[model samples]
Target chain A: MMAVRSTFGRTGNHPDILAGLVFIVVGALGLWAGRDLRVGAAAMMGPGYLPLIISSLIVFIGLIVTIMGLVRDNERLDVIRLRPLLIILVAVAGFAYAAESLGFILAAIWLIGVGSMADRETRLREVAASIVVLTTFGILVFIVGLGVQMKLGPF
Target chain B: MEFLDSLILGFSTAATPTNLLFCLMGALLGTLIGVLPGIGPTATLAILLPITFFLPPLAALIMLAGIFYGAQYGGSTTAILVNLPGEASSVVTAIDGYQMAKQGRAGAALAVAALGSFFAGTVSTLGLAIAGPALATLALSFGPAEYFSLTIFGLLCATVLASGSVIKAIAMICIGLLLGMVGTDVNSGSERLTFGATELFDGVEFVVIAVGLFGIAEIIVNLETPELRGLIAAKISRLWPTRDDFRRAWPAVLRGTGLGTFLGILPGGGATLSAFSAYTLEKKVSRDPRRFGKGAIEGVAGPEAANNAGAQSSFIPLLTLGIPSNAVMAMLLGAMTIHGITPGPAVIQNQPELFWGLVASMWIGNAMLLVINLPLIGLWVRLLTVPYRLLYPAILLFCCVGVYSVSNRAFDVALAVGFGFLGYLFRKAKCEPGPLLLGFVLGPLLETNLRRALLISQGDPSVFIQRPISLALLVAALGLLVLMVVPAVRKTREEAFVDEES
Candidate 1:
């Protein structure tokens, strides 16, 4: 699974290594947490028992997945693209925050417009036109017909 | 005759102006989304589910079912014309299909696929009509123990269906089940895995995961691979298969129908598998196997037919047993439950009209798909010609609006975004989302039945073994696992799994 990298003077195994380590550690933590529940009398299987079993299974699976990933050398996990992902992430968070104040229709209109504009290819005119047409339809369908009363922004 | 009479009532219900209109509309939309890469039936249905809130349950279901199977037809259109299979089932279509397109026979490939799917749709609906009641009647006697064992069997079969590595597939499923456990524990009313987030209390919504993973992740992957942008083949004329093409394809159709009918019955891995199996089966049975992947008409026709039939027949098991055979079917089942239909053995008996009405509508939708797609092959090809960068943004917008309209919860939209990342990870990990979805949707039911079975047997684990039918099913499950693992069978298994890579 060792793939040759042209640069960095070292194998960039950080991604898989970190993920594998996380799984193994999380599995251990789960096992420790789940170990104490009562096994129950005659026929009752304790909830903790299942968690225990499941945690162990996860640990085993995670270990295998991690090692296999390392061995396969099938992919190269690029450093996290902070710039674009950050914009999309913030926009989605904005979408949630807007849902209440602006209401479903208005918030959605903004969400679509803003989200699309984040990408360079989107045009302002197209976004504005789409906002009008689609929002009008959304308001009629969800608010008027379905009776969901999610608030729109300050009147 | 009684079956015939109820079927007549079904026609009466389905043939109504609104129902037929919705059926046609459903097929139209289904094809549209299917033709577009990255948009599958589950996300499309989830987005449109809110619209159903305004309709009668029957009409809502008819429309939703149309979206589900209708997408299957649309899926192949793109897979053939473009190198991309819009969904897993259509992957087989892309094999010989893209070959044909490359060789200037794009028209023939499109004709063969659309026709083969139409043929399967007709036959499988007939299969559903004749076999559903019989299956339901048989299912009437399943005790809690049997169902619990059957659920286990279903989970086990998922490993058999997974590609690359079966172990990873099962591991993903285990993770899926654990994730499913994040919400409230219904029976005990205990907080199990919430870890305090209010969002976790409600558990992860299926739509969020489906949309994010399938819809959003596809975008990221597409962005990564520049080689996979648009339909690379040149333009073609009228939608007609040649005489030689027809002669080669007819047998493939029959073979595909057989594969589709049975695999479609297996939950979670139907259309994708059916199509591929149809291709490989045609190849193995062919007089010249070398022609298999090299623009062979039989290769394209068989899998397309089988995949379509498999998509259609998958409904039989789910409708009869309340067991979701796959993610899309599970989503449909979820939609059904939201409409207050308890989908189990009694669904057929309690709602015969609803059940048969849906069956009849499949025929209608299939017919509509053929009409819409064949004459409009050029139209769909033109649609593929649209730059994906432009096309994908509109779909993303649809997803936003669709989610917002449904619950009117921005939180849901955020969930979709989060899932998009998760879907990316899944793609990176090389796990098929279908089986994971099966695990998620079926988790609660499987848990409930396992608990009930335990209660019924008073904790006797032998109940599963004691019942002959359950024993048979469990044995079959073990056999399936063995078949999947045997070294001698490994080559055959890969071929089957490849067909489903759609």
Candidate 2:
């Protein structure tokens, strides 16, 4: 069973070490560029000076991360689960496309039906029931009640 | 007498049926969204922000303010009942609220929160009603440098708000500042950091970044869970605080109102600091300090109260001085600008009804929230259980339509999509979406103001120091910067800092 706590850990990767390494390299480049970019102002403050200062601050912060990552911090490797994620992405894309095509009610019905079906155990009949119930209520509330505009179809 | 006249006028405007309805809708919607985790008010406000384009400025401000604190109230419910915080300020609430729930005292916890928040809001709003005109005068005396320094002050306090780690928070703040630097330079009319795209000229849209980060990114993250939202099935009880709960909560509410009201006027660190400070103060004053992380009612009462109070107070800087304290306020200011209502000391004098009406409506909106939320808790809980897969497509559709409706630009919708993916990347890279949203909202204002101020000063830097208000703000910002590097402040949360390494 995937616990709620564990479910959130996939937000990022092998914790500090790898993240630190990336920040370290990026900061180093920023620092190098800042050193070159720091031209002294003659008439007014050089435009690059403020940014150079900011860039150097980034470098120092990155260096701190680099050192911290080296000295024995336990970081876990997180793996992404792709299947459901892909399905969600596709469902969202489909909803975007069909939203104007099928009209809000029909489009919403199909979107809810198909999106919920991403779970293997979800039955077509159950999804259909949910879709019919929700979309009908949505049309009543949003279109009829609230006067929200929805283009149902191209025709 | 003049103030009185203005107050009466404002009440007239606020009393309009359309404005009242908007206020009620804002509060009701705020409570609904606030109770649900993963839907922060920033995104919701951004998505709805365009509605103000067609509304009078007072109504727009009234509604946005309702949503802000209303969300604060709503988040407390989830914190108490579900052990999940819908927004950052509620993190402190969850510390004791969840404990209260586990111990079968969630009813008392929520009741205490509601009552305390109500008291705090009332007291602080009165505070605003009294002090706002004076502050508006002080703000009227301000020059460009003063306003500029105030903006710097808002940015500087991100240090105090550096949630987990000071170092990482600083890094993020700097990154936010850099991101704010994107789009065109108002001074030169030269584009910066757009990679030369025409869309780059306007800079990033708040709707795009906010929706991408908070809405779409939340959906993507939720997709990984493969379960519905609100996994916990907390049992709720009566909606009244016991005498003992009231006795314990009253002092906390008072302290929270004071702290929140004061901090809220400071510009940047208002609501966030008020919540954290209230939590700490409660723990310090608690008869049993250890009960803090457990289900202590004071913990829930104080922070919730302070958070709401702080939210109410934050508007002072924006309304009086025309200097926004945070991203949401910046958006409100933008809404005002879109309506051609320039907020300043003059606003109160010229449009007394708009100002006073808004103040009166805050009182009204808070009352509405307490009434709507308490009995309707079960309704929100039911809404929370709506499975993510089934619910998300609807949200996505609304988001697209909402984006398109405001801009009527297909490019805006497309931009939203790109930002959505980037939002996911930022999440995976350990960045908080809040500051990024802040950057996008404040960028145009910061750039425009900086240029205008400089143009007035003829490119002189000393103008910031010469102006008293600006000087004070600069001093505050300087103080914050120094404290960020202080060992005492930095040492206490080394673990929190380490977590921000990414």
Which pairs clash inside model 2? A103-A152, B9-B353, B10-B353, B10-B357
Poorest lDDT segment (10 consecutive residues) of candidate 1 chain B: B222-231
lDDT of 1 by residue, B1-502 (tens): 8988978988887899989999998898888878877667876776666557667888888888888888888888787777888777788778788889889898898888889999988998889888899989988898877887788787777667646567666765666666666666776665555556676577776666666666666655554433355546767765688898899899889889988988888765678778777777898899999987789999888988998899899898888888777777877876786677878789889888889888888898899999998887667666765555455555665566555555556777787787777666666545666666777777777767776777777888788899998899899888987886688798877755654543
Tell me the tens digit of each residue's lDDT in model 1 across A19-94: 4544566566556644544444325555554556666887897787677666655455543433334445555667
Q: What ranges in model 2 sit over 4 Å off?
A: A1-79, A83-155, B51-54, B98-106, B165-196, B199-201, B226-239, B268-272, B290-295, B337-346, B452-463, B466-468, B493-502
- Chain A only, candidate 2, TM-score: 0.54
lDDT of 2 at B387: 52
Best by lDDT: 1
TM-score of candidate 2 restricted to chain B?
A: 0.88
Off by over 4 Å in 1: A1-42, A46-49, A71-84, A117-120, A123-125, B82-84, B99-105, B198-203, B223-235, B401-408, B495-502
lDDT of 2 at A110: 55
Chain A TM-score, prediction 1: 0.66
Docking class of 1: acceptable
lDDT values, one for every candidate: 0.73, 0.68
